[model samples]
Every structure is written in C-alpha cells, then in structure tokens.
Target: MPNPLAAVAAVMIAVSVAARALIAHRGYLAYDDFPILSMADRNDPTPDYLFRLFNNHFMPGGHLLSWLALRFGGFGYGPFLALLVAGQAAVSVAFYRLLRLMLPATWTLLVPLTVFLFTPLTLEAGTWWAVGVNVLPMQLAMVLAVGAQVKYVRTRRPLHLVTLGLSILLGLLFFEKAILAVALVFLVTACLYGDGLWSTIRRWWPSWLVLTGVSLAFLGLYSALATSSVRRPSSVAEVLTFIGQAISHTLLPGLIGGPWAWFPAGDGAPIASPPPAARWTAIVITAAFVAYTIWRRRTTASRAWLLLVFYLALVLGLLGATRMGSVYSAVAGSVPRYIADVAVVAALAIGVALCGIQEREEKAAKIRMSPILLTGLAALLLSSAFTGIRYGDEWAKKAGRDYLANARADLATLPAGTVFMDQPVPEGVVGPLSAPYNRQSEFFAPLPEGPVFVTQGRDIRVFDQAGHVVKGWIDGPANRPGPRQGCGYRITGGPVRIPLTASTAEYWHVIRIAYLSDRDASATVRLGDGEPRGFDVHRGLNAMFVVVYGGGAEVVLESGDPAAGICTDEVAVGDLVPAPAN
Candidate 1:
C-alpha cells in the first residue's frame, strides 16, 4: 500500500485548492496579468522574444512558467488557476517529504503540515496569477532544495549535491529572494547535526561555495538588467524599520493573531502598524520564547531551533529584497502574499517545538498528556482557513466586478486608432486605462484586433499632426472663454455644436449639460440627427439634457437671446441614465 502520509498530504492540497476556487472564473486584475496575457496570446512567442522578455526583468523562471500556461491554456482564468494550484500541491508534497525526513513517523506531524497548507496568507499568492507565478515556483524550488540537502547529508551522494545546486539556481531564477534556500539548508544542518560551527562550515564549504557563486551571478545579471521602478532604502534606519515590521508581521499572526484585518476583504484599508499594545505584547512573548529556547538548548533537539531560524531567515530574506524601499509602508510588507512563506515556516517551527518537548518528557517518564494544546491549534487552523476562504470570495467578487466594469468602459469609450492616456481614478473605481506599465500597443491585446494605442501618464488631449490643438472636440477644446468662474467652456459664438466620437455615442445614450445664462433664455439642444429640444436657461447654473442612439451626435446649445448666448459649465454623459440634479 502507498504511504499513509501521502493520503494526508493529498487531502491538505485539495483543501488549499478548494479554498481559492472562488477566483476560478475571475478575470485578470489591472496589473502585469494583462501584459502576461498579451504575451501569451502572441502567434509567435519565439526564443528571441522570450529571452528579451526575461532579460528585461529579474524573474525569468516565473515569466517562463506564465508563458507556458498562457500559451497552452489560452488566457482562461481557470487554466491559469489550475497551474497555480498544481504548484501549491507540489510545494505541499515537498514539505511533507522534508518533514518526514526530520520528524518521526507519527500523526502529530500533520498539525504543522495542515497549518502550512491552509493559512490565509496563501490566498493572494494562490489566487492572483501574477503573484502565484513567482511565489509558487519559488516555494516549490526552496522546499525541494531543502529536501535535497537532507538527502545529501544522509546518503552523501553526488547526484543529491548536484540536485541541490540546480534547485537553488532554479529558485533564484524564479525569485531573487530564493537565495534564502541555501541559508535555510545551512541552518537546518547546523541545528540537526553540527559538531562545531567551524567543523560544519568546513564540511559544507564546497556546496556553499557552489551555491554562493550561483547566487552572485544571478544577482549581477538581475542588477544589470532589472527595470524595477521601486525605490530602494537610502539609509540604515529605513532598512531596520522594514526588517522589524516584516518579522513582527510574520510572528504575530501565527502565534497571537490579528493580521486578518490586513486582508483585502477586511475594511479595504491598508494597515500601517499593529496596535502599540499588541506590538509590546508580541515583543514580550517573543523575548520569553527565545529565553526558554535558550535555557533548554542542550536538552532540546536542534529541529525546533532550525525551524525558528529558517522562519526568521525566510521572512527577512523575502521582505528585505522586496520591501527595502522607503516607498513601501509597514502594512505593505505585511500583505498576505509576501508573508505566506513565513507562515509555513512558523507552522513547521511549532510542530518541531512540540516534538522536541514531547521527546524530552518521554525520556523522563512515560505519560500521556491532555490533547488541549493540539485541540486549540486545530481550532486556530480551521478558523484561519474559513476566514481565508471568505476573504478570497470577497476579493474575487470585487476584482471581477471591477475588471468587467473597466472592460465595458474601455469598449464603450475608446475608438479604433485612439491614443489613450490615463488619469488616476479614486480607489475602488474601475480603471483599466490607469493600470501600471500599460503600453501603447498592448491595450486590447487579449481582445479582438483593434487599432487602440494606450500610453501611461496624463489626461486625454487631442492634437493634430502639426502639434496644434484640435478644436471643438469633447476632450480637446480649441478656445477658452476668458474670465469664467465655473467649469467647461463658455459659448460666445452662434450655436456651438460639440462633436462626439463613435465610442462616446455608444457610451452615452443621454447627455446632460450644466450651464448658466446671464439673462432669461431658452437653449436648444440636439443629439445626433434628432429634433432640437429646448430647455429654460436660468441666470444661475442650469441643466440641459438630451438622448441619443447609434452613431455620434452634436450638442447644439443655441441661446434664444444672443446678447448672453450661454456660459456652459460641465457636460456629463451616460447610457440612458437620469440626469444629475442641480
């Protein structure tokens, strides 16, 4: 029969996948997801193109995985999610194998493995394709590298050493932060089977040297070619602050709780720091935990210490590389995706700690203790899993809604050959045009063929080939009324007709204009070829409305009295919508 542990591992993987199923049908978020989708839809993703793409960034392995998924899966959310779930499953299996190598064959190991598999911290990484593409592969590589180190220690096989080196290299390519894999292996070896610090270094120097060389080469390539726009830390104070926040975030949630509020589903606001009281409490608890571990250093096995050290190293390594910039807030470093690896490390540490204590107790006397601690841990794990699933569902709903709204807006407003520019919208609003790194050619790459050019920066403005402002266009005004108080242009000539494009015709079936007249007058408004509709214009701000269908229209604002024609301020349009009240 197959190993019983395999069955447990399968269950954990299934549960993890099931928790994130809410996002299976969701569309891409307004980020690198669209660019990856664009590249994947290419008819010829040639080696040259792929090389250029990877060389432009630090994550070649991650981009390679995304390319394969998009090329084969055809940009469907389900297929991309399946790839991510598969990566998560692979990581789970690797962790199980690594645990089996360290811990005795007992059901107790399941506790830590379950926690590792089900933590809420995994939701963003598992559900978001852009994040998962980097995180999942790096995690799998890290775990496999650690397992290879364990095997090499036992069998002293050259193949295992080669496997370890290759795994580390692969992990580094996937994410620059994967350099922690070597550090983790060294810590585990020292904790579990070190004779002396010098002796350990002497024995492992060859493997260390190989991995170090690989890491240095990878760093050099990344530094030379990296096009990251993120700002790096300028001072030692910023570095310490970033690292401290990362460590506190990693520990507090798994041990004491409260980071759940940081999830996107909760409050929809980013948290800068934990409460002062909670921070103090965490500091005290951490100090006490460290003191206890030191007091029992000789009696306790190094497995627990290994787990603790690895946990710290993982947090510091990942966060230090990514969150070193002063632009990053404390809460930014605490995001669930960034801390998932830390959560897994914490869970393993807890398991190893329990195992160490139990072993020491059994050596003194044979006794069975109450399962209260185990029961509490189980409860925490279940609660966290449920919370994670709920949060995933909420986040998926928001992302899907926002994406659909943005696509609809794009389709309605942007005409073929239109050069689109983005202006920042308020948070929570639909804004695909305002997404980061949006290129002029890839605006609608995932959709049907279109002549749309989208560029980043500034608001929409129309200009002719001669660089002169194109007049009478809704977005580009030819003339400005001098000394006006309100918004929009003040009409001085005969009846001014503002032309609308095809996109505007489709987007807005109704047009509403806010205006003001110096004298009592009636202004006529015509949409498309429809008959003119007249509205009484008051001296103060007034409103005029019209409805249109199919092709573009012209808004004719002709004043009954030409002495004070019209001073129009704001013109808004929407599809068959009621006009806003003055």
Candidate 2:
C-alpha cells in the first residue's frame, strides 16, 4: 500500500510545479535575460564562446543552454519558461528524496517538505529565466549530492559515492558557487552521523580527500578563466550590515511567509519590502519555533540548528566579502537569488530537528498532527503562495515586455534593408553598462527580421524608447558655416577646412552634412586631429550623418577623387535626435 504521506507530498510537489509554470508563463525576459539571448544569437557554437565567462561566472553549461534555446526556440518565451518549470520541478522531487533519507516518514515530514515547496522566498529564482537557469541546476545538484552522501553513510556503497561526486560536478558546471556544496555535504555527514569530528574525519578521510582535490582543481580552473575581480568590503561595518540585513530583513522574514510587501524594481522583477509589522511577526514566530525545538530535542536539535547556522555563515560570508563592493550591494540580500539555495538546506535542518536522523531499518514514527501545527502550516502556505503570486504578477507586467513586443511588431512592418543608425537601447530595455548587448542592433538580433543598422547613414531612422521609427537628424550649438548661403563647405580638391565658431566637446559627436554632389564619390570627414571617418557620397542633394570621436574648432572634408567633388551646404556637430514631423 502506498503511504498517504508520500501521496500528499507528491500532490504538494505537483501544486508547486503548477504554480511555478503559471508564474513563469506570465513573465517575459528582462534585465540579464537579454544579454544571454543576445550573446547566444551573436556567437556560434565555438569553444571560446561556449566556455566564456559571464560576469565572472564560468558557466559553460548555462551558455550552451541559452544557445540551444535561442536556436530552437526563436524569440518566444515558451522554451525558456518550460525549462524553468522543469528544473524547479526536478528540484522539488530531488529534495523530497533527500528528505526521506534524512528523516523519518511521518506526518512531521510533511511540514518541511511543504515549507520547501511553498516558500515565497524562492519566487525570484523560480520565475526569472536568467537566474533560474543557473540557480536551479545548483539547487538540484545540492539535494542529489546530499542524498547520495546520506546513502553512502548508511551503506558505504561505491555507487552512492560516485553519484555524490558527479552531483557536485554537475553543480560546478552551472554555478561557481556550487563549490560550497562540498562543505555542505561534509557538514551534514559530520554533524548528523559521526560521534565526534575526529571519528567522522577518520571514517570519511578518503571521500574527503577525493572531493577536496576535485574542488581545488575546479577552483583553479575557474580562477584562471574568470575575468571579474574579487570584491572586498570597505569596512568591517559593511560586512556586519550585510549579515544583519540578510538574516534580519530577508531570510528570517522569508522563512515565515514574508516579506508580504512587494515593490517594482524598474525593468526587473519586483523586490521584497515587507512592512515593519510583518518583519516583527516573522521574527517572533521564527524565534518561538527555534526555542521550542531546542527545548524539546536538547542536543539533537542544537546540533541540527548549528549545522544550519554554519552553512548560512559560509554562504553569506562569501557574498558579503565578494559582492559588497557592487553598486547593488546594499540591497543584494533583499533580493532572493543570492540565497535561494538555502530553501532545501533549511528544509533538511527542520526535518532533522523534528524527526531525528534516520537509522538503519528504523520505521517511521506514527505521530498525529496537533491543531496548532495544522493551523501554522495552512497559514504559511497561504501567505507564501499569495506573496509569490503577487510577485509573479508584477514580473508579468514589467515594462520591458511591452517594449519588446511593440518593437518586434513594428520591426516586422518595416521595409527590408531600411538603414538605421546604431545607438544604446533605452534604460528601460537594458542599462548602458550592458555594453554591446545594450546596443539597439544587438538587442533586436533575436528577432527573425529587422532593418539593417550602420554607424552612419543618409536618410536614417532610429527607434524611440516607445519602439516607433522616426527620422533622425543631428543638432548642436557649434556649427562651421559655409562660405556663402545655400552653399556649404565645398570639398572639390585636397582637403576643405571650415573653421567652427567654437571648439566642440572633447567626447564623441555626430556630424551632419547637407550637401550637393556633382557625381557619386567617396569622402572623409575629420574632427580636430581625430582619425577621418569615411562615408559614401551620392549624386544630387541630400543630407548624411556620421559619428566621430573627439572634437575640433575646425571641420575638414575631402573627396576621395578630386574630379568627383561634393559640396556641403551645412555642417553641424552634435547628438542624433528624432526630426520633428512636419
């Protein structure tokens, strides 16, 4: 006969998957998602591209996954969302298996399993495709490795040991931080199974030696390949603050179905900002539970809690030391992905505290659920589900989704070969820091068809922040007036130098030329001492814009062939803006 608790657990996992799928389906690609997709679209399946580090993360597996999704899935969110849900489901199932190995099969088992499945704490990692791709694999690997460790401890099986190694390796494939999984496995084995630290070491020395060597080798490879430098906190107070906020403001409240409040984070998913009342309530509830468990289980509970504390310290310490220097460090802990991996570990610790470690041939205790336990479980589930759903709704409605949709629809209607000048995407799409990916051409590359883009063009169009195409023209305060009206600086021979009223700014500036050419020819424009930019001149009268770096008080223009001359009537240096519709 099937165990009723097992059936309940399966149903809960199913519900969790369903909820995740619904939320992820509603969410569109945002923030870092674009960079991954853009990179995948631009690069071929070469070793250099595949093994490239992203923001210091050596995630070849993640890169490969992104590439596959872009190739097979096109621009739709379905493939990525499907993968996201599937990975989350795998994590839930794997965690259940791990829980069974660590704790007795009873009503008590349902508590931790439900908490792990329903916690709003992991909503960010679950719904954000960019974060999910890396986080879920690491989470899955942690649970599998821990389960294998438990099995190895009980049976001393070579197969389990092998699985343990492979699981850790699998995590390292996706996230460099998975190296922490080794320490997690060691902590579980030593604290839960061994009588003393030395005894555990003696018994598991061989396993420890092999795993340590593997970790060290990977660390060396990661260090060599990753380009980002390690960041350190400026002061001791910064480190202390990170720890306090992470525990007090984020994790503690999160464990108890908080923070209940949500706020938009620009184009990214919503961030947590529970009210003070909610925070205090979460703290009190969590503290009460901790005190009760310690009083009831004495040393057994204390050891389990100690394991949790040590693991959190290691993970948080790593983040505080390395990430505090980041611009977003003040609110880093408030965002969930950095610590999302802790959900499963928390469940494991809770299970051990409630049910004790599983013994060989031990049968699950038949414990009845009390009224208070039932009430608490129901409240946590409802509150967490509500908060997670609210967050998902915000993610679904982010402005980036509308921007991309509008841009794609408008792009599809444009004439083929319509030339557009390249520019940085609006801050709503991606920040300037994203660089190559933040450029309009790169951001739009995932679309099947779009207008051609160039550095400079005649009659060029540009997409406004709303994704509408508009005529572009250059404007500036400084202009090198032509010698006479209706006739700009005429470039007939060698180099025609037109002196400006004042020197231009020292940064990049766009130069616009309204000129008449007797015949088609090549021309070059130089600003100050900067290198000359080459452009094509067409017959008849027209205007063109070209980008040049640096600035000078004089403008220089020259025709490639003296016989094929071009006459410029107007020359102005400045930024490109949408021309007013007449």
- lDDT against the true structure, each candidate: 0.57, 0.81
On a 0 to 100 scale, what is the lDDT of residue 515 in model 2? 85
- Evaluated against the true structure, the overall lDDT of model 2 is 0.81
State each model's C-alpha RMSD to the native: 11.1, 2.2
Give the least accurate 10-residue stretch of model 1, judged by summed lDDT.
464-473
lDDT of 1 at 473: 18
Give the poorly placed runs of model 2, Cα more than 4 Å off.
Answer: 360-367, 478-480, 561-566
Residues 541-571 of candidate 1 have per-residue lDDT tens digits of 6654444333344555677677775776555
For model 2, where is the 10-residue window of minimal lDDT? 360-369
Best by lDDT: 2
User: What's the C-alpha lDDT at position 281 in model 1?
Assistant: 68
Clashes of each: 1, 2
Per-candidate TM equals: 0.67, 0.95
Cα shift from native, residue 445, model 1 (Å): 1.4
